[model samples]
Target: MLRFGLVGALGIILAIASPALPAAAQKRFPSSAGELTVDTVASGLEHPWGLAFLPDGRALVTERPGRLRLVETDGKLSRPISGIPSVMARGQGGLLGIALDPEFAQNRLIYLSFSEPRAGGNGTSVARGRLNEQGTALGDVTVIFRQMPTIASNMHFGSRLVFDRTGALFVTVGERYTQRDQAQNPANHLGKIIRIRPDGSVPADNPRKPGWAGEVWSIGHRNVQGAALHPDTGQLWTAEHGARGGDEINTPKAGLNYGWPVITYGVDYSGAKIGEGTAKPGMEQPLFYWDPSIAPSGAAFYTGTAWPQWKNSLFVGALAGGLLTRLSTEGEKVTGEERLLTDIDARIRDVVQGPDGFLYLLTDEEDGKLLRVRPAR
Candidate 1:
């Protein structure tokens, strides 16, 4: 029941209690879109991860512990909707991302990404189901995609789902910490962006040859968590975590190599060198990178008119940096950067522009919150 003003105070206390960011990681800039205010829409969520608004103004929220709930327009949360598949729920793995079908109004279909457990081990997976008419459960659930080479390690499940204009689903996958080299292998799904039809079939025009596993769109990513289709160009952009540094924002191209372990701006956890260097012969450089990692999560392009200055800008949630990053872009290039909500001191997990022309964010914590952001009157 804490209010927004009280939440600000709580954030300040949290900043004081937590360890300070390193000098290189302290990159806070003033917002250019004038004064802004944050309102707490809902609280007491257990590590809320993904958010998607329904046509009726209610929002579908996913918690990392594998529960899905509906948040009413007035911020009341409904009981956990039934019919969710069992998730592995291990370290850095659980129910991760959720998205509504482009034609959800008609089909009532929804998609979810999670860590799926199997006999050998667990891997990232995507499932589709129809929301029951009573909104109490899901029906006709089916797993559409599963990451290949299921490994035991629980970290580095790079999962975020986005649908392209043509109705293809783009899925991000991570290189399961110990499987960095596999990112370069076309035979596996680790460290790659894969595009598939809603029914789990590979599109004939996929970049890979017919013999290759027809799902991979690009390769050599580290642990991508944030993904969005560019509002202007319709291109796919992603934000991924690095080892110690080298957090990157990239626009993935078909069949291109991103050069993760082979070429990285980050070093190992032990301060050892990662790749040959930041550059290699055929790898593509990121549109932007953070030297000290921000640990970015979900992302959205601000297409709302409520904040005209933010229109077409890219907003990403920062986990380690504890802020919302606004990247000003000119077409495909990032022109400027600003860090917001630093005073909130919450690990921002997701950012979505609401249908009502406001921005919504999910804070990651034991007592996570759904926050609304708008221009101050």
Candidate 2:
């Protein structure tokens, strides 16, 4: 069970220190659909970062300390599955994202993203492996993709994996914090979205120009964490972390410039202005932005039937704000906003819709938990 006393105290401190929203805006938005019932499905996880459900009704969860565990339908976590590649396991850098092969039933393949340590420095790397029939260890593990220009910083490894309907894969990355200026450059993979085939080969129709890296899909991103495919439009949407303010949600198009430091609604940590203003020509604007900075991580477009009114809403996990934010969208624009799970006071790491029509959340803490959300009885 969660330590309510300690968690509550942390929540109070976060509420007092949060500068992103005004006092009035910080007030919880009461759920209009019904009271939410939150249950602790699993606990004692060490900073669980990503989650992926398997074809057999079990799930795979990755810990930031470089271990992966299998979770049963009843929330029982198995012993750490072996055969994962070595990881750097530093601040904000470790095992980050996981995804199952679209044809997992036949191939039993899985993919993982982590901070790989090298002779010079560390960089985000992706690997694929086939799950052995015994379900205890991986077979044929192979490193597939590695981010370019590996740096020494332990921060800003924005690694999230998502597969489009066409069987192509998208990888999100961050501009190593000190290398913010590199976000606008195209020669490297820093601060860019990468598109490639499942086997880590460049797609023939990739939008990179003559001087840009062949895997680049979009440029000028800071550190993108949350990514999801629109349920209707089938476009790729991402949530990016801002420096001080200016947290943004964007639908990244192929070969486009997103304007990270050049144009942002946020400023530096010292409260200095950023860029030449919020708007500029040639750079793409955000579909939605947060002034104070919610520090959004994982996101999913809800299509579940359990919450009928929330069927089409976008659910985003907020770290600094310590809540689950629900945004109602009209086409590409966010029309309304609501915040949930504030009373729990935990930093939400990732959110995903489960196969059973409920929402699952991962809390970012030493004693992280897997929570299931449903309508209160």
Candidate 3:
């Protein structure tokens, strides 16, 4: 009896000392979609950064610490799948994003973007791999697209993989923070959006310029983190992070320059003015921008029928703000904004729509969670 009492007392003391754990399974919250419930599908993920739903409803998830996991439907996370390339898991770098082939069921191919350790330091690179039948490992892994002039910095590896309707892959590259000025220089891949074929070849139709890389689709971007193809227009849309302010949403067109260091609505970290004011004659402007930065990440447009009111709404996960941002858009312009799930107070790293018409989210914590959003009973 004495031993049992001591163990019980210790459990209570530890619970009091530790921070509150997020509610298990399901919790209710109010939102524009009416009363909704967030179910904790799985926990104990280490900085989970990407999520890709398989045809079987399982998901391939990546941890920033260099592991790929398969999350089963019943909330079991398979052991780290084998054959992930050696990643330079440094600051703002690591295994970043993943995308499925359009015909994944047939080809079993998947693409991943991660920071690759190079001779100098590291840069973001995309790799393609085949998932074996048992789903226990990735095989035939091949490095497809590698960002140019591999620098030594660890910050600003904007590496999201998105595929267009014509099957072209769009890879977003960052300016490697310390090299923000290169974002304006087309001589390198830094700070540009590049479109390439699945086989890692530059498309013949890709934009061409004297000094621009052949794979360059657009240039003059800051660190773009969130990106998705518009459900209605099929056009590529991206979310970018500004210095101190000026978080922006942009629809990047081929060969266009998005004013970053040259023109910005943000100031530097030291509170100094940045750029030559906010506009330039030839530079493209953002569709919408946030003055106080939200540090936006993975994005998805709600096309699922689970919530009719949320249809066509663009959902973006906020890492710094610890919430989900819903932007109501018409045509190419943002009309309204709704910030939801702030009460959870977790850093939302990725937002995705499941095949079951429900929404899913990844929290970027030491012990991150895979959460599902559905209507509350």
Candidate 4:
């Protein structure tokens, strides 16, 4: 029953004030470990979705409106960089997940996930490019992977890019709202977590089912928004949206089928039953699930010494709850939960740990903000 720190009787007084407070005001909040300060790093972003820190401490940020910018530690933002491939930018489809190449320091490469336009509609796709030295343009960008059977819907493009320790890239895609049943089919890319090499090739050791799509790592996901490799074990973990309830936290393994519409801890928003039941043989179960969905987006496991008491805590940004949810983890399982940043009152689109051991967050808004959370003086 512990939060991220030592709750020394004043834990109840840690509540924050309104999120409208000026960024320069240096508002502080009490926490079990110590006081936390929330500072605005940058603003004017339109629904910023993903963040990846550069070697020099600057960050590449993506706005869902199909623009990309570089943000500095001091809150200065670069112009929307040139050379981003076109994005659909319709409904939930747009520029989404991003990550640096594991060998970025030597190769200057980066990857981006977006909803690519197709004949029928759009689907999630990943592209790689070299970031120019000045960080002003992406060069030699090429689409490496495109989800199959693009449908005529924009609602469920699960785009989160995470790189495993072995340098394999994991891309999460959702079952297009009208294609829930496709989640159960391994032959298609919808509602699936795909694993691939950095160069768009399938790995030699990837999971294989008879007639399984070579890149499909696991299937039966709804609309996964949060995906991260466990900081300790290197397993891919994800948090996905559900209908009325049934938000799930899963560590997807190779060749496994995580039942979506077939087995959910939820019902349709219209109160109609979904799937056969919550559990069945031959389908993988979530390590943890939420009954009342939180609409989780970004994920990061705190590995910072700044908050020693918070080491290894899994932090998830909630778009629906407008808060940051910290789950205490014991290996692969979530044991306890604490919701923070409630006073911010912003739909947190993505959260990442900075190079300096602090937390950085992107708010999901037209005039979205990049916020820094750190120890207060």
What TM-scores do the predictions have?
0.91, 0.91, 0.93, 0.93
Model 3 bad stretches (over 4 Å): 1-24
lDDT of 2 by residue, 189-215 (tens): 999999988899999878969789999
Put down candidate 4 lDDT per residue, 165-195, tens digits, no spaces.
8889999999989999999999999999999
- Give the Å shift of residue 224 in candidate 2: 0.5
1 or 3, greater by TM-score: 3
Q: For residue 362, give model 4's deviation from the true position in Å.
A: 0.3
The lDDT, on a scale of 0 to 1, for candidate 3 is 0.84
**Worst ten-residue run, lDDT, model 4?**
5-14
Q: Could you tell me which residue pairs clash in candidate 4? A: none
Query: Of models 2 and 3, which has the larger TM-score?
Result: 3
Write down the lDDT of every candidate, Cα atoms only. Answer: 0.83, 0.82, 0.84, 0.84
Query: Which tens-of-lDDT digit does each residue in 1-377 have in candidate 3?
Result: 00000000000000011111133556667676577778788899999999998988888899998999998867788999999999999898999999999989999999999999999888999999999988898999999999988999989999789999999999999999989989998878999998999999998888888888898899989899899999989999998888888888999998899988899888999999988998899999898888778888989988866566667888888888587778778889887777777677899998888777667889999999988776666
Clashing pairs in 1: none
Question: In candidate 2, which residue ranges exceed 4 Å CA deviation?
Answer: 1-30
* Model 1 residue 192 distance off true place after TM-score fit, in angstroms: 0.4
